[model samples]
Target chain A: MAKKKSESSVSTVPSPASSRAAGVAPSHTDLLRQMLLIRRFEERCAEAYALGKIGGFCHLYIGQEAVGVGAISALRADDYVISSYRDHGQALARGIPPRTIMAELFGRVDGCSKGKGGSMHLFDRNINFLGGHGIVGGHIPLATGVGFAIKYRGGDQVCLCFFGEAAVNNGAFHEALNMAALWKLPVIYLIENNRYGMGTALERASAINDIAERACSYDMPNEVVDGQDVLAVRDAVLRATQRARGEHTPTLLEVRTYRFMGHSMSDAASGTYRTKEELEEYMKRDPIIVLRTTMEKNGEWSDTAMTALDEELKAVAQDAWDFADASAEPAVEALTEDVYVW
Target chain B: MPVVTYRDALNQALQEEMQRDDRVFLMGEEVGVYQGAYKVSKGLLQEFGEMRVVDTPITELGFAGVGVGAAMVGLRPIIEFMTWNFALLAMDQVVNSAAKMLYMSGGQFNIPIVFRGPNGAALQLSAQHSQAWESWLAHIPGLKVVAPGTPYDAKGLLKSAVRDDNPVIVLEGEMLYNTKGEVPAEEYLIPIGKAALKREGEHCSIITHGKMILVALQAADQLTKEGIRVDVLDLLSLRPMDVEAITASVRKTNRAVVLEEGWEIGGIGAQVVDYIQRECFDDLDAPIVRVHQVDVPMPYAKNLERAAKPDVPKTIAAVKKVMYLDQ
Candidate 1:
């Protein structure tokens, strides 16, 4: 097989001018703020989990904030979003209220899924956020179906399906991609290659480490982007979404990123499967700091302003925690509700 | 009214529903180009065109999930599995995604999709292909399991299943595809979760559904000649089981025998027995006897396969046992 050129390889550096030329992009400061909010929200979630406030398996999206924030920024309000279990960032990026997400984590009735979905199964139909499906690669087919519906209805809406690198190994991934490609459905299969699927390293799980290369079998257009850079992920995803909406074509995008925390709260962040050196190397390219430095270089933000912004985000996270704490548990009668529709 | 085969009845239901609703479409392996594996979806592709009657790759999980996704967003998808045995590959999507989406999303999504296919034993398909899944699927809370016996019920119930705003599993009998029955010339729909009394009798009630209904009828005819009138109750829908119809039949006859094409343990008969004993214990003249396929994987040998399945003799024996005439 010949080496396939990644569509995103040409644009490694972030250019605000290019982003502006792309038209109506989120300001650099706004993107930074959103990523910061997600970081703080995840940190608060870890603290709450330790305090026995948030039960069930809680997978934090600490390091891969840029991938979620950047990709979701490109999608239209009517478009659908579906992701794997590590979904706090995606939920926040899709504009689900932080309080509702926090309440869902707290298993409250005010939660998005009314305490039924808990952490891994957050859903908001109003914004078209399909779900935070717990099973790996299980939601891929759903995304395909969403695309099929759009085509069947003669709509230009696109579906964005996000999964980890480990999900590529699942049979569902291949099956969904094949169907989407064959049908010429409007969908974007975004792979957040965070280097580790739970404790299993990407090298240990997948035969071909370059996740985008696997898309060749489906004859779908594919790209690899620097997931640590918010602008790069945004550009690639925007292009993919446009292709999906305009041409009714699906794209397989592999965003190279990493997670700073363990797979979930259960796994110790100790360097057992991975080394401290590897973790430190990825941390040096931390997505938030990378974007913040770019803004600083452009003279768009100041040190004092950045500090104030961090404090504001912290306050936002604190308010969400407080709101979730005060929310009521779901009524026992609600246990049977929504199970069936007549 | 016209006489039609079970396969033609199902095809008519699909054609009618597709014509009635543009949102409803047929999708499965060989459904479009090959006219369905058993011709259940025959002439549909040519009628509805490729966009509606989609021919999918041999990927059950993928197509099943796609059907679910489409249903979530306001499309009524009719996903044919070719066979219920092959649906095992896509059970995850069926059970986890399609069935639970409405509840998990807190009533935001109602998957109005029908997963229909031929189920249970057919000739010598044997073991892997011959297993009946009505009991297993009925065990699920969010699903409606429909197994029709006659062509009339097949067409009417399927039309209703397509219209239902929930995940409905229509288990078509493979052996009954060629069987003929009279169907209404005009439009009609048989409501799900309702039973039909094929034959009313005074002595004993033989309750069954799907292909076993035929065996029950034959047995009823044999018992009638011996001066033992038997009530043949056909349970068209398994889930949301028609307990009222069952109790009424048992009450009328004061004796009952449950028959099934599936394994004896944890089968539909077992569930019917539980309902009868609990609700109609006073009306029963004797303990209800269950006739079901033997508790073993269906063997490929002709004689062994015949012995493993529930047949006319077995139904007669069960009815006799309930009537105290088998000793």
Candidate 2:
């Protein structure tokens, strides 16, 4: 596996000089492919919700595809990842089978969490995706502890804890970061600053706009990146992860991003805090569109190949939906199982 | 038989358990370097090294979650809080993850972790440092709550807790750690959800556990001198409590006195008495009596603290009242 190091190098596409330096790649085709998969999957979830198929609190990871794919693309398969309730895109980007994720959403026996955890508690142990914790910032400390375990067991695994900008105000967020920095744990605290935390915009809640600067309080290095640009997000994570693995130093990455969807499937897009015009402006910087334009210019992608991958993804997503829909609910006796180590 | 202090028995139980199972390990504040707050885990670090007998930083939540995660995998982790009072910092991990993980995951994950430490009023340790949290833990369905009174029960129960596949909270009384008793030098397993009969009688059943067990035993001896045969039963586990033993004793004795060191209103003793009344209401010769500390903070002075806690005199009076001896 070490001999395939060169083959594992991150892909590239051309972008603006400023963007390129920050790690924005020109590979619009690949970026668009990932963004489309997430968008279509979430759209299907929204449809499922309307049809009364998926129950429990379902937090869709729609316009936040770039933060997950761009950042996750920089990580190795062995590295661990944990995220908050808005976790579907991250799980997908980390290579979890869509069928398992859909099954979890559908509350089927075949789900990643075996139907025990619906939308809020998605857990895929195989992909090293710890969970989709329902608590606001409950899993932050958990990620830091896992990082400590990785270091303690003498492993090169880095833990990426993805939380929202709203979590910056949480006591756990501060407490976990301080402890992580103090212990010099191999972790990257990725705050996907998507402006809104649930219903409230972050500006209305957080006293500090730049969460990356908060890392300074713990004497850790911080970086601010364009979350919309997959390449840029990847670059920031690559450097931070390298430092975490090499020097055993923790890094904080504040990815400035926006979520095009409401907090949940039920929430309307219209709101007092965000204007339609502002939403449109951010949509112009849609990660998929930016990547696609770059790929077209770089000649790394063609319309035919893009079309083929799009069809392939749609078919795969449909298969996932069918598999989840056809799967049976767990047995009634299973309700009392796994409570104790009997 | 070996004369062992309650503290040494607990240390031996932990040491023996660690040696017996590779997955069994201890994690706490001073459990490794300083031995333990009460020296209950002394000298095990040298034998097991840092891996098994881990000395963690004072981040209760962090270590507690780690214990939960480790238990979720294959390891059986024994989490020692400096005192059960400090476990409040990790209550979410215990209550939410360790206790409810099985039910919430639809029975996919069973947490085989033990959260053990001294619990309840310990001298003048102050209000913040001393508490009886067994009732709070017992309220949860999945957690097994145990509080042992004697050296034998403590060693046997602690070993059982370590071996149990479910999360168990073993509440060791701080004052009872030094109390000495004869412990058998052989492997023994104490099944959870079982009660122990400390003394045999027929007049009135005295149901109690932990520190109050001593009080009940003393009260039985005193009552025997007065021609009152008081049956004493030590409740080892609070959850999945021995309802059968309690109800059967209450039926046989025809009267009862429930004793506990916690506040009188919502104590484990109250639960025992309630269960007896609910299960065997027709068998009562007299109304049930609850002997507990007055509803007040444990005082600092030794006399005041003793006055606030249930003692042999209080237990004797409660037994007499329940058996109609005064009548």
Q: Give the winner by TM-score.
A: 1
Candidate 1: tens digits of C-alpha lDDT, residues B1-327: 799999999989999999999999998999998999999888988888998999999999999999998987889999999899999999999999988888877778889999999999998987999999899899987899999989999999999999999999999988899999999889999998999999999999999999888899999889889999999999999988999999999999999999998998789999999999899988988988888889999899999999999999988998899889989
Give the whole-model CA lDDT for all candidates, comma-separated. Answer: 0.90, 0.81
What DockQ score does model 2 reach against the true complex? 0.38
| Candidate 1 residue A170 C-alpha distance from true site, Å | 1.1
Question: Taking the candidates in order, what DockQ does each have?
Answer: 0.77, 0.38
* Runs with alpha carbons beyond 4 Å of true place in candidate 2: A1-32, B49-57, B106-108, B264-266, B296-307
Docking class of 2: acceptable
TM-scores for all candidates: the values are 0.95, 0.88
